[model samples]
Target: MTTEITARDKLLLYVVGMFAFIFFFVQFMLIPALSASDQAAADLAVAQQAQIAMQDTIALSGTNAAAKTESWAALQQANASYYGLLSSSDLDTLVSNLELGHNLAPLSLEISSINTQSLTGYAASDKAEDTAAPGEIDSSDPTLATADTNAVLMELAPPLTRVYASADYFKACTVTFRCTGSDSDFYTMLDDLAGQYPSVQLRSVQIDHAAYTDASGTTTGTATFTVQLSVILCDKESVAS
Candidate 1:
């Protein structure tokens, strides 16, 4: 059978087709394109944020490194100064100079003892007695001389009664000596020792002066003065080794 077509009907069919095409274009193409553009913008923003965070981390690391370097340099300088003082030979030379300078005195000056006792041992004793009797010897052996000296020194210089070294490079020892002279002679000896020896620190000093009449019955002259002195020895080789 053959069907009849009208112009109105044909125009109506064309309008319906145009409306369907417009709906599909907006839903499938335009809407998807807009969504994809929004997603891309979000990803770009995240990447920029990550880049900024990375830059901040790098800057902090640089600052920390510089601070560490400066601290290390300061520590090195301090170490150098400490080592220089420890290695100096001035202290050793001072001892000899003091001896020479005081040798001219008419009074007798003698180092009776030198002691290298352990700090621990000295502390262990219940009663710390540093001075020996005037004529009594703790031991007849010469090896005990150092201990005796240290004892006398402990009595003289209470501040340095006990000493310890921070490292093996530093050596500490004590010296004990007896001096018999007039008041003037004793003063001269002390002055010369201090002036000549920078390292010879006087730890202890004891002066025993007694009045006695001379053969002429004159009480004008000083009869006798007995002194005990404590000396410290610091040598570079002893410390460096």
Candidate 2:
């Protein structure tokens, strides 16, 4: 006996096959495509974040550069304000001013000593240069001959205009002095110096006291104070009124 499928069975088979195909496509192909799209979006977000971070870093670098320039300008300004103090020639002027200030101060001061130095490590370079004989080499210094030769070459070298040429731009001047007085008097002297010279900066201050008994058995003591000041030194070209 031969048997054949009816039309209803064939239609049911067609519908079942369609449903299976749809299920497999969604499970294997469509779902994975959607997952891939989500992953791509996440990666794009991360890339954008990285780009923003780089931009921020660039901005910070520029800001730091500008800040450095401003700091350098401030240094120059400070140096200009101390043009007088930096000069060995100005030593007499300093003493004269101090003498005048002492007379005007509220207390009497006993000034023991006053000294000046260069911030460039060599305190009395100018004095040494003046005292050295022509073509003389300091045998104590191995590099002295080379240094002197370089100095002569530099002096003879033609001046080339440069945007940032400076003579020892990082250098400054230092002044130190010792005085004997009471603490209040010391403060008064400090105030006087600060008032008279705007560029004078107090670097260090120390006080020493000595106590003694006289014939009357009265207790008395004296205080000695030491003070140091710093002032920036600039090239003559940068000097301003």
What lDDT score goes with residue 35 in model 2?
100
Q: Candidate 1's residue-wise lDDT over 32-133, tens digit each?
A: 999999999999999999999999989899897777566545644433332122212443343334444554222444443334434333233213454432
Note each model's CA RMSD in angstroms: 16.8, 15.6
TM-score of 2: 0.37
Which digits, one per residue and each the tens of the lDDT, describe model 2 over residues 31-52? 9999999999999999999999
Lowest summed lDDT across 10 adjacent residues in model 1 is found at 161-170
lDDT score, candidate 1: 0.49
Measured with C-alpha atoms, the lDDT of residue 153 in candidate 1 is: 39
Q: Cα deviation of 218 in candidate 1 (Å)?
A: 3.3
Any runs in candidate 1 off by more than 4 Å, and if so which? 1-100, 103-169, 223-241
